[model samples]
Target: MKNLYDLVVIGSGPGGYVSAIRASQLGLRTAIIEKYQELGGTCLNVGCIPSKSLLDSSKYFSLAKNNYSSHGIFFEKLFFDFKKMMDRKNEVVKNINNGVKYLMKKNKIDVYQGIGSFKTKNILFLKDIKSLKEKKEIQFQYCIISTGSKPSCFPHLNFHLENRILSSTEALHLKEIPKKLIIIGGGIIGLELGSIFNRLGSKIIILEPMEKIISNMDDSLSHEMQKILEKSSIQIETSLSVSNIFKENHEQISVFAKYHNGKEVKFIGDYCLLSIGRIPYTKNLELENIKIQKNKKGFIHVNDDLQTSVKNIYAIGDVIGGKMLAHKAEEEGLYVVEHIVGKKPNKLNYDLIPSIIYTYPEVASVGRSENEIKKDKIEYNIGIFPMKILARARTSGCTDGFLKMISHKKTDEILGVHIIGDHASDMIMEASIAMEFRSSSEDIYRICHPHPTLSESFKEAALLNFENRSIHM
Candidate 1:
């Protein structure tokens, strides 16, 4: 007899596990299949969770070592033990991973360990790894594909583990910090990992094919971040094409690349990190039999409701591909499950979704940026307030970067908000909420904000838009 489930979610990533729990809550017999030995997928295992852990540790280390004197706090010969720091991050990740397993068990979601493929629209084939046993089939009334993605490795680049060549995954598990590190691709991963190591006293250089890192973001925003990174002594080389990588000496590797101006430059480093981005990990899914459609980039094609070509099968998160963020995937997973349970659900507002980069003076933004409004030829009024003008910033001694708001010139409705400074990620959420309610700049300005707070910057920016009068600025 074949096992049957009301819902079977393939891939145990954030999207898959969350949806499985929701299905179980809705009184459906649900099962989840994970190819990896670990339960929490890449985000929990290596990507988001672990990276943030390291970033937080590194930030504190940098601050204690360098800025303590200015804050009127003194610690002679301040130091950070790399081994201990990494161990703490690992412990945090392990706790979270175990918590996910507990949720699956508590929710009564069956977990199958191994690769899964679709046999029919409603049937799934599971391959057991340990005994090489094959499960004939399992039937499901509804399916969710949340296979997620993996880091892209260049075939031509010889990634010698012994020589300290690493991908973002391996970089996170480093035993010793490199004296000099050369990173390929200056997108989110490269910039983030680079920043962590850079703060730990590593000389870093980033190579990018585009004219700027974070090319999808607003040009001005990227410029602001570049300046901040430069202050940390990190170098960025844009519009550079890497020709080849070779071992120059017994101790160092030489990377050859051409600059945007067609000049060849050589870089020597103790280690090279590849942060080129990720491709959807759909290789073993055997997508041919089910005839599910995919985009040109090999990401599964889904409708506005996130339903694939097959009506009952849905795809979300990195596999479906928009921002490739864990939070966005969780939202989609919850929405799909609710919709399946006969609840009238609202579609995800992609516009209000915030993007955060956890470098020094973290970057966060939501809604359309000034660049996007201009590109679309929309008329908007812009208001800006520097962190230097905020009393909270002065107290924290992190008075760099600013908050900017974009609103409709005629309607005064908030269009976009961007922030690049301390606690930017946390502060951007309020702006996102305001925009979601279609609040105008005047409405935001009228709100009572406590004096001598970082949050006051939001009110000041809005006031600048309402009238040319911001009290602090």
Candidate 2:
């Protein structure tokens, strides 16, 4: 007997699993397939979840080692066990993985664990990861590719060297912190992993090809974050392209690079982390057989409806590219499922989606940046609030960032909101809500905010757009 499904999702990541559940909810018989034993994909396994777990644990340790002394809390001996921390992180990953499995069962979505490939228009070939020769076939009306992405490595530093060369995935599972760590990219992953071990006593040196870190974000946020990381003893060398990586000894590796100015530089470290970014992962999907149209970069081409060139087959998440965010993929999954079920759901507001960096004094932003508005020649008014004056920040001693609001100069409608301070990730959601309603700076300013809180800074910043006055400063 041949098994059939209304929708068959390939790659049980955020996009795949969510789409499968939604499809089943919409009265479609759905099935999801994963190559790995776990369903949460890279984000739950080695990317966002595990990295954030370690980062959060290290942040508290750092506070105990540095800030707690000022808060009148003294420790006789402050020490942390890397093994315990890693174990806790692994435990967290397992819990989330199990939760995902529960969701699939509750939704009655059939899950097949194996490598899936397209053999024809409506047929899929499946094989066990261990026993590739053992094959199974399934039929589906529609398919979604959401394999997610893998950590990109420098061309010069291959995984063949093993321990000396690390990707963000390997870095998260390290048994011991390196005395000196050299990161090759100054993007979100590098900055985050660097912050983790730096707090745990590793000397971090970031080598960025760009002139500024987080170059895609608001210039102010990047500049401020760079300064903060520098003060935390995280060295950053920008505008350099790596020329070669040489193994110095069993204990150290030498990195050679050149500045844009043609000056050669050398860096030696116990370990090197390559966090340049990620590429679309469509591994073993047999994309060539179907001839699904792909870009030069291997990203599957999808239209507004998330449908690829093959009408019934769709692609989302990192495989199709955008922000390479898990939430973005989740939204795309829901969107595709709804569209397939004949529901008229409004298109997602990509501009309003928030991007967050989980470093200490977390960074978050939504909508167009001031520079983006400037490039478009949009006359915009700006409201700025320094976090140093916030009572909550003063009490917490984490007053190192600010909140900025940009709005249409004449109408006062908010165009963007950028934050870099404690609870910035949580606080940005409020801004996202306000912007979703097309709220003006005046609108947000008039809303009541609790006193002695980090969020109050946004209200004050919004007030700046109207009266150029903030009550505190």
Candidate 3:
């Protein structure tokens, strides 16, 4: 008799593993399948976790290099070991990977070490590992497809398989920082990774095809980030498209680009980091074999309950698209499991989800941007507060951006909150929670926030929304 499960989640990413654990907690026999030996998918293994690890380390390096003297601390020339930095990142990742493994054990969830795909609504096939030839099948009452995404490869590059040309995964494990690094995209990944290596003394240049970096974000926010990057000595070239990439010398890389008007420019770098973004990694699953469907962008479509077109199968995470945040995937995982267990989970508030960019002074936002509101012709009140006015930011000496709060002018309901400054990622959660409760700006203003803290920015912004009176601002 073949093995069976009440729930089988493929991909072992934030969605897959969390769904398996939740299902097991619900007293359902559950299993999770991962292609790699390690359990956590891209978020844990190569993407979010590793990126954050490097971001933290690089931030420390930046602080030590730039601000330590201002704090009345003087030291000899500081040095950072690139190999040690990578080793530390690997150690953090391994620890988290082990934690996931331990969670599976504690939850008594069976973990299959191979890629899993549906053969039918209730059946799945796992490729045999030892023989590398045989196929094994398992039956499940329900399944979650959490197969994540891979870096979207640019076509014109001829695809450098060399170590020097790296995706996010390869970039995370690099032993040495390239003296000159060319980043191919200006999205979150490109900026975050570029910021890291640049802080570590790499001459970094970000090539973005769009008119600005972080094109999906508010134009003002993108320009703010561009200014910060420029101030940090990172060159950002926008409105440029990559035509091709070729090898110049054995070590030097040639990048060819064309402007909007057919003007061509070339750049030579020691290494090229491609961060064009990622596409759903559903190819290996042979989704067509079972009639699993995907969108035009290759993302699998899922209903509010995260149910796929096939009733017994579901999809989540980067595979399902949106803002590809790990927390979003984890929420979907839990929500889907609850949905499977006969509980009608609350619909995910897509607009309320927050996105964070781990650049120097982190950027985070929830709900709509002012640009979106204006585009929709909505009458809104925009409240802006410079982080420099905040006591916390002045103490930290890291005030580089401001918080912009958008609210319905008539209703005073907080429509959106966007921030780009110290601890913005951490602070945005409060705004997200408020938005989740449909809290108005007046309501947030009524709630007393601790003074001399970063969170006061939220209260001040809220105050500014209704009345033009921000105490500090």
Candidate 4:
């Protein structure tokens, strides 16, 4: 009984730690298990936090090297120290790691640094991460698994850090900026990492097997973003299926691919980054001991309440595989915690959870995409306003994208909002809030948005959506 807890959460990523904290707050004796030495998992350690830190640092360096001159700001010479940027990124991650540890202590949740394996529906054994020796046994009335995901690679390719076939994790820790980087797959991970290196003076070539990069998003977004990235001198090749990747020598890598029409091409670069996708990390949990059910994709199966086949156990975050966004995982963590406490929290609106890509001009969308609405066969009206027309855009010199609003033709209710522009990541929350309340296009149009702000574009788009007219254009 000494090791018994009301709840035991496995994995200390955003989802796991957050659920543990909430459980403690709800007066449950809780504990969390982490296999890594550090507390925060991939998101804080590598995926979101480190990536954004580098992104911001690289963006500043780029502005000084290219854009400041047009604003009457000129420097005799502009230079950046790549080492310092990486140092700052590491420091940021370290601070957040310590912060998570402090939260565990503050909340009085027992922290176990080991791999947790199920022994029964109500019992788990913690083993030393490296030795695989059982260290302790723990019991819990309920359990939540949030062991996230890892970058996936092709079946034939073996990733060795020395050979420079990089995943996003390896790409983040490069000692030097590559002279040329070849990126396979142009989803959020590939494009984001490519943008970072490109801004830092690396020649970037992106090969996407699909017809468009960011293919899951709105078609308009794909078209506009491709144009923007290409204009920035990043080479993008679509409809190419990579056949093989091999090291030509110690310093160079080669990628061989074929086009849809069967034309073969080869690309050589200093490094090849594989960003095809990620797989749910459900390894070493020994789920078979307890007969936990998982789908064919290795993601644990959970019902409407996020309950596993064994009702007392639940799974959240990338292990269960939905959006795979940190925020989405965090929300699911909260939902599971509140559900356990009988708080009866509102069910998550999966459709309204926003998706964001943090390229130079960010892309974000919430609610249904235009294509999804079309697939549903719903009658809808569309309104689009370019960001360039806004005075705020001209003032800031960020005039490359637009805001598009889709609404029901009959009821006038806003259905989806898509944007590609400055602050698109932050700007998307407005649309999410509007759609969450089932607000109409006229409602957003009538709301007063401050002048000389990027958000006014939202109002203009809403006006155009409902009335088919815009005040600015």
Best by TM-score: 4
Q: Kindly list the per-residue Cα lDDT of model 4 for residues 1-473, writing each as its tens digit.
A: 33999999999999999999999999999999999999989999989999999999999888788888889998987889999999999999999999999999999999999999999999999999999999889999999999999999998886667898999999999999999999999999999999999999999999999999999899999999999999989999999899999999999999999999999999999999999989999888999998899999999999999999999999999999889899989999999999999999999999899999998889998888788999999999999999999999999988999999999999999999999999999999999999999999999998999999999999999999999999999
lDDT of 2 by residue, 1-473 (tens): 45799999998888889899899989999999999989999988989899999999999999999999898999998999999999999999999999999999999999998998889868899888886754789899999988888877666457533548888878887877899999999988989999999999999999999999998899999999999999999999999999988788888989899999999999999998888889888878888898889999889999999998899999999999889899899999999999998898888889988999999989999999988999999998899899999999998899999999999999999999999999999999988999999999999988999988998988999999878898899
The candidate 1 region of ten consecutive residues with least summed lDDT is: 127-136
Candidate 4: segments with Cα more than 4 A from true spot: none
Model 4's alpha-carbon lDDT is 0.94
Candidates in order, TM-scores: namely 0.96, 0.98, 0.97, 0.99
**Which order, best to worst by TM-score?**
4, 2, 3, 1
Which residue pairs show backbone clashes in model 2?
A: none
Instruction: Provide the lDDT at 118 for model 3.
Output: 59
Estimate candidate 1's RMSD in Å.
Answer: 1.6
The reply for model 1, stretches above 4 Å from the true place, is: 129-133, 158-160
Q: Tens-digit lDDT track for model 1 on 1-473?
A: 67899899998878899999989999999999998788888889989889999999999989988887897888877888999989998999999989999999999999988878888889888977555456668899999999998887777664555777788788889998989999999888998999999999999999988988888776667888888888899999999998888777666878899987989999999889988878887876778899999989899999998999999999999998889898898899999999888986899999988988988788888999777899898888888899988989999989889898999988999999888889998999999899999999999899998888888988999988979778876
Among all windows of 10 consecutive residues in model 4, the one with the lowest summed lDDT is: 153-162
Cα displacement (Å) at residue 336, model 2:
0.5
lDDT value for candidate 3?
0.87
Q: Give the range of the ten consecutive residues with the poorest summed lDDT in model 2.
A: 154-163
Error of 4 at 253 (Å): 0.6
Once fitted onto the true fold, the runs of candidate 3 whose alpha carbons sit more than 4 angstroms away are 129-132, 156-163
Off by over 4 Å in 2: none
lDDT (Cα atoms) of all candidates against the true structure: 0.88, 0.91, 0.87, 0.94
